[model samples]
Target: MVKVATTPLDRTRVARAALKLLNETGLEGLSLRAIAKELDVKAPALYWHFKDKQALLDEMATEMLRRMNEELAADEQPDTEWPDALSAALRGLRRHLLMYRDGAKVYSGTRFTDMSYAAPMEAHLRMLTGGGFTPGAAARAWLTGYSYTIGYVIEEQSMGPDPVKEEGGYDLAARAERLAAYPLAAAAGDEMFRDYDAGFEKGLAAVVAGIGATMRDAPGA
Candidate 1:
């Protein structure tokens, strides 16, 4: 006979518990039963709110986006520079995602059609439009910036902590030395490794600059 688990679950409580578990166990270790246990509810109860694990995962992604939405509202509102404003908003989102384990993984491929995400998305579009970008160009710009932010953070998080294990660990240094044949890689070295926030800022700025340049060069926009 199979043993069954016991716990209470609802959408709100389960989602909250799921996020907590995600922070602790990461996406690979996440499970419906694990979340049910966190909420002190039966696995079946969790099923009532979420049809399956994928649904739960999707909801978790939404929760992360909602947190980003809140931060952008408070800190990344439309400013004098539309590109900078969009970049800042995306960087803010990356910061929030970094707060959790496998956060970018969870957010990746998740859809943001919910009304909650619409306001921010619309604001970004409006800001781009105000900057003289055509609708098609604005959409591309938004996607490009968003993808860059997400891709950067995903790679940043996957690299895990510094590869250096011991105080005198040569893992990083040796790796750097081995890249001598690759001029760009060797030149990057420690300079490429940066504080998460700084990386986000730098990347965001670069992407925004690229978009601005493109917009300026576009004909009849």
Candidate 2:
């Protein structure tokens, strides 16, 4: 058995250290032991603060959301339309997720460790409700946008974080060769794999439009 450290550690400090290590190692290689070494402590030292890896992940995701919220708040405008506000929020989420390797994976399913998420979420719902959507419609609209943001980031990170800068990650020529039997599918690879920024914006625009068309009703209007 390994020895435990007697020194006390702050949970946020441990989580922040883990976030930095995440960029170097990616999610598959991150472990409590690795984090302990990063902090120059024994593995058991982490257990006192985090019961297990999942608990630590919860905190990490929470911290990521907190930072994202801070950024969004800085850019927020009181008079902005609901669609623009929602788009900005999701765009902010994507930017933050792309900051770390497997950042989307780290954030996707983990539960937040605190109530910090409440304010931002409530604000979003209120924005939708104020825009003339029913409560149920507002909730659904927010979820649809949030889900798209998370899913898009997951795929974006899969090609290596910063697919734009990663060299030789997607071999369009080889992919086309393999799909020679299906010329259309082969030709589609470039549009699908390259220029993620434009693709994301186009897709998000469609999602927001659909939400507005389908959900913006006064019930009695």
Candidate 3:
């Protein structure tokens, strides 16, 4: 077989290529070899940059956050309330995670490869602290919001890239039939599967409110 010309490869370049391939092949089909092929290099060429697949995933997740941070920065406004800012940040995260096939699965539980996440995290924590939360409370509050966003995106992606546009994929009628023995669960299928956008907003608002009410009066607040 003839060799494909190799490109100069770096961690960022490889990770970005992997992210692009991810949309085509998805997380399950993604491999070092696949990324190498996408980058026009041998599989071993990737090891010079990433120690293993997990390391590559870490870089990809970090890149995803970097992009999300850019979007958040672009939309930021002066003197926004903490809850509003936090909500906006989480919404941005959800949108970012939904951009690729299995985007949330790729992002969830992966360690970041660099300090790119630190500055935005510091800003988020500062926002919470300024809103009368103790440092610990600030951390917890952020974790809660982040967890909700990640979990929600994962569920949304499980349905499809765009749940609202692909609503037929969910088979709500079948779901309702499956839950027919329990009348309330059958009825609840529409609320749970029909409109994710509205559901996410309502859920996010609840999470933000819960965090504020619980953390606002912590010891240092």
Best by the lDDT measure: 2
Q: List the residue pairs that clash in candidate 1.
A: 7-40, 7-41, 7-42, 8-40, 8-41
- Summarize candidate 3's per-residue lDDT along 1-221 as a digit string, tens digits: 99887656788899899999988877889999999898878898789888888898999999998898888888886588888989988988888888887889999999998898999899999988988898898999999999999998788778643433443357778888898899998998778766788999999999999998877765336
lDDT of 1 by residue, 39-148 (tens): 66678887777888778877878877777777768776445577667767786877787777778888888764357778887988888887778888889999998899
Q: Rank the candidates by TM-score, best first.
A: 2, 3, 1
**TM-score for each model:** 0.81, 0.92, 0.90
* Clashes within 3 Å, all models in order: 5, 0, 0
Model 2 C-alpha lDDT per residue in residues 35-149, reported as the tens digit of each score: 9998889999899999999999999999999998888888888778888988998899899998888888999899999998999999998888888888899999999998998
Better of 1 and 3 by lDDT: 3
In model 3, what are the clashing residue pairs, if there are any?
Answer: none
In candidate 2, position 72 carries an lDDT of 87
**Candidate 1 ranges with C-alpha deviation above 4 Å:** 1-8, 76-79, 162-170, 177-187, 216-221
Model 2 stretches with alpha carbons more than 4 Å out: 1-8, 160-165, 219-221
Say what the RMSD of model 2 is. 4.0
